[model samples]
Target: MPSAYVARVVLREPVVGARTWAGFATMCTGMFIAILDIQIVATSLPTIQSALGIPPDQMSWVQTAYLTPEVLLIPLTGLLTRLITMRWLFVASVSVFTVASCGCAASGSFATLIAWRVLQGASGGTLIPAVFSAVFLLFPDERQGIATTIAGVLAVLAPTTGPVVGGWITETLSWHWLFLINVVPGTLSALGGVWLLTRDQPSGLLRELDLAALSLLAVSLACLEVGLKEAPELGWVTPITLSCLGTSMLTAVLFVRRTLAARHPVVQLTMLADRRFAVGSALSFACGVGLFGSVYLIPVFLGFVRGHSPLEIGKIMLVTGLTQLATAPLAVALERRLDATVLALLGFGLFATGSALSATQSVATDYDGMFWPQIVRGLSIMLCLLAPTRLALGHLPPEQIPDASGLFNLMRNLGGAIGLALVDTVIYGRVSGHATDLAARLASGDGEAARAVGIPQALFAAHAGEPADPATRAFVAPLIERAALAAAIDEAWILIATLTLVVILALPLVRRRAEPTLEKTP
Candidate 1:
């Protein structure tokens, strides 16, 4: 082929070559922060809540505000790409994200904090799907194996390192540093993208903005997310909760009808018709539940149940991050030669095994008890990110890849949201029941129960104004609460384990992704 013709082809699509590494890094920086921001704040929630004087009931909105907008924007990324060149969209988003981080750090009130979080999430959500789209567009098959591995590392590494870094920042310094921390890295990613990459991202022909669909999507997802977050504390029967649910459902129905009927739909829902795409999406959702669910569980169990400090919790969870990097090279190696089905099954098996080991934990479980399970999860998580990506995307026509990637990533986020809700329900529901059962036995002067809680049966005064105040039935209440929480945490672990293993049933629906053309254009 003539050199000029080759140049044109390269211009049309991102050609895999030397500069690909630099561009990938720039994009990864944006992706890492977007994803990492979720967990970094996890360890510092209490500090943030108290610092801003947030009421206990409203504290959850700090996380929910960010996550809700993030999830809402994910499915719309492909549509955005169609409107603007991807490079410009990404750069603009990183800039918006950077500005929002600063606003969050400067916030002095609960409402102010939530306003910034919504902006931050809106931009951060687009980066993940953009990176996934870049993987196929920028590289060929052999290189894609290596590129995907790198992406997997960033994806898994973000949340894994978040707790550790966030813990250190909170314990050693102040909670405000959590948001201030993003400034340097975020700026560089946005600027670096402008400098290193050739700006050739293309857009679709139709340019009309679908305001109705956009409004419906935002209202539906945001209302639903807020409702879910508040339900645990507010009680599902509360009028506020019910209203949020009702409004969300009405908006969601409108959004769906608008999407299917529109000439240029904001979302291309037709992709779900592909069997491979559908099955792959389910795998993505399940992995999201496992990945996000487990991440949520370990920290809460260690912090609330065991009463560990943020730094100590970080140290315990750091094992998962360290082990994820350790296994990346090997996972990439296996990904190269093995079928997606085989790799997915293996990853799912390891993750399930790890979750099961964790389910056996009692109130006494600690760093040592959790070490093996963390290791297994870290090793398996990379394969979870890699194989499903290929299964969902490797065979799609390149033009359709962007839209498909958006939908694929959206499922994972949805899974995380739903998984957390279900796990919360299970824990809250079980705690009261477990406490009741244990209290009944204690009330009867069960010697075993007395010994288990370190309270002497004789310490009870039997009447008000007890003599052994410190050792009275009041002391026993703490034990029952801890015991009940431990039991709830254990049950949550079992739920996640079962969810992870159930992926095996969907294995038959998948076919190994076809290797794409790796050769430079003729």
Candidate 2:
């Protein structure tokens, strides 16, 4: 109902044209498969490892390989968009992704599958941000809300449904079908998409690649991502990790200098000079942290501590997707009429509240107990996703949109990388400290510890390391670890809550969109 009213109020004509919808549909299909692939692979990693004889330790690289390039390529989207044009870029990315999917499905070796995944990730990363550009470029302002809302839901829904979808394929068919399933949709998304959006306008004329900048950028992000991923397992200060960190710093500094001096930089660092864009990009980073970090925390908590199956956790997580689906239409409807900054304030506040509430969780917290926080986060994330784009590019000039889009989107991924690292530090670093403290407190038959874990003095005296029943050993160890873990997670949740509240300082940077200055040049 509000969509109609907002359309009427904002537009003199119908905004959702046939071509517009067709273009948007193509984008949605591509993005869905892209996102869904990530989650599916995650759930099916064990099977994949078994199939390819991948070492348990190296199996994580399957994901790391994909994400490193994805993160690297994301910042260079504007350059790519300018180099090949949006039409061809979209087609090529989808095509390569499809081909990579085929390669992964047919892969006979661990190395081969990882190679294909890297290709898939590079291609897929392009489409994820492109979806947003399409929302602004393919549609008019009045209709952007609806388009963005739909696309946002697809992105959010993929994570929610991934475990279920991955579980189903593994149980019913086989893991190969997970990759194979993408072939049809990805093909259509590529071929049909190009044919539908046949028109093109030159955005960037920079024909040459900034090789130095590209190299530094690639190394910097690759190191940063890999370093963060490895930090929890291998101590952060370990030699290899320190080298990665140091290398990332060096390359990052060089990349910034190189890009600043270059005539046609791969990433438009200048875009951040705009006050609104800078603030918006920062907010996007925070949003990325919220989105990816929360997703990481939930599955981890449920799997490691709560002992819930992936399927059950997936069902619990579906509440977020459902809540997002329910609220998206209204958020999109308000996007045009409401000041983006105001909506952002409301979003950050609710998100902070939800994160704070979750911090109070105990070992007993379950699906229903966490339900309201899911709803709060779900509703807030829509605003988080939608508002940053509006705040950043909504006010920029026509020619600045593509570069700004790339920069804006990059912040989100960077946030995820940095946020996950922080989460790990909290869990790995804090849990050990908490465990030591907890052990000391429980040393002399502590009453509170007794009441909390339900272990009597006699059981507490039993050494966990002794030869014991498998069931008893598992139970006792987890009981001790869970106590320490619960405290650590609560502390991490509080940290996340504090971070969300910190977004308020950036709210003032988001000015009202200049309606007349807004251009339709996508």
Candidate 3:
């Protein structure tokens, strides 16, 4: 028989009062630092690499090590919380994450740093879903919107400000400060969690947890993360990529089947059967494509095509972050009056428009070109986050919220991983072909092509009616590569935009009613 353990897991009534709010805030703080670490390391990787004497080929693993384990651990957090209870789980996660951050800062070599990063990733992964889960568990429906806004703002804000913060820290102090900065926040969050959170004993559900299903879940996600990371460079059909992805799919199937049959599943998979949660998860995935992909794309364009430094890129990228901050109030107000599906459609529609606008970019595009697109996208962020979040978790019972939150958040991360891989594939596969085509046009004395490639029409004019000398070709080669890169990046923007637009179709399936759909386990 299926166990009644799910019903038994709600250890107390929904959290209430000022102390609970403080506890929620502390959880948010821990989550913020954890998310910030990903973006900060991305922005400061070059500096970190030089400091540690890491080879160019190996530097990327610094990030992959962090990301792979984080992905594997996120969904598992639902079960982990049952084993320890939320209060101790939050405290322990924060403490371990802080210690790992310190170890990262103190590391003297590449291997040492990666080891610390793996630990950091494992501990930090739980913080995000834990905060989102708290919003529903700690607040009434009337107040969940405002609370979601607070958590959503911080969630998105961390990534938006990470580049600027990381760049400033590395330039003024040192790359070590990137990790060190997490210490103060982590310490306070850990202490606050212990003091403010309601104490509850674990349900002692470990005996009921399915170890085989747990292993399958971990292996599936780990393999999936690895496959996505390698697919862009190695080609999706290559043996290693195929093996990893195939194994991920196979294990995922077995895991889902095993969990569905288990008396007490490790992580709740039945939540996805609810229409609201299911549709909301899909929308969340789409938002991830836009949110994380744009963050990744903008920095690459600014650094490589525009020849900007990390600080300059960060400053330029501030438009999106600032606009998001300015729009949060309006989004919260609107969430109260509108149906969630309506709000979600509006949010995703505007996001799609913004992404489409960005797809028209040229090599010379800068903050001026990006400003309006950033504003449109910024306007959509909170709308995209708040509504889908409420739709996904709002109707679930307090006990189910934790597991559902983990699954919902997992969809977004998976979307980000896949979106980034596709973006990389587009850039790498197209740049060479685009460069070749532009070179051909230049050779044919096309002034329009000359202008598009950032070469002076006069340069082409000087070589008019004659084969250009090797010197001229060499000079123009770099310009052709730059223009090619810009074109490739634009295509990537369109790909994400299309993805965002496509998910909007599923909104109708979300049902107009907001009542809880699951049979309460008893």
Give the runs in model 3 whose Cα sits over 4 Å from its true position: 1-15, 514-522
How many clashing residue pairs are found in candidate 3? 0
lDDT of 1 by residue, 1-522 (tens): 466545545534555666777987898889999888988886788899889898987787788889998989999888888777678878988999999999999999989999999999999999999888888877776777788888878887788778889988987898888998899999999998887655765666655668889899889988988888777667778999899989999999999989889988888888888878887788899999998899889888898778898778878888998898888899989998788888889998899999999988777788999999999988899888887888888767666777898999999988888888878988888999888877776776566655554455565324323333455557678888887887888898899889988987898987554534445664
**Preferred candidate (TM-score higher): 1 or 3:** 3
- Cα lDDT, model 2, residue 124: 89
In candidate 1, residue 250 scores what lDDT? 98
Indicate the residue-level lDDT of 353 in model 3.
95
Q: Candidate 1: misplaced stretches above 4 Å?
A: 1-14, 444-470, 511-522
**Cα-based lDDT at residue 210, candidate 2:** 74
Of candidates 2 and 1, the better by lDDT: 1
Give the clash count for model 1.
0
lDDT of 3 by residue, 1-522 (tens): 223434533432454788988999999999999999999899999999999999998999999999988887788777887889888989999999999999999999999999999999999988888888888877877778888999999999999898899889988998889999999999999999989987877864667877788889888998998898899998999999999999999999999999998878887888888999999999889988889999999999999999898889889888988899998999999999999999999999999999999998888899899999999999999999988898898777777888888899989899899999999999989999999999998888888888889977776788766877788778988999999999999999999989999999999888788333455655
- 80-173: candidate 2 lDDT, tens digit per residue: 8777877888899999999999999999999899899999999988888777777766666677778878888898789788877887788788
TM accuracy, model 3? 0.95
For model 3 the local lDDT of residue 164 reads: 92
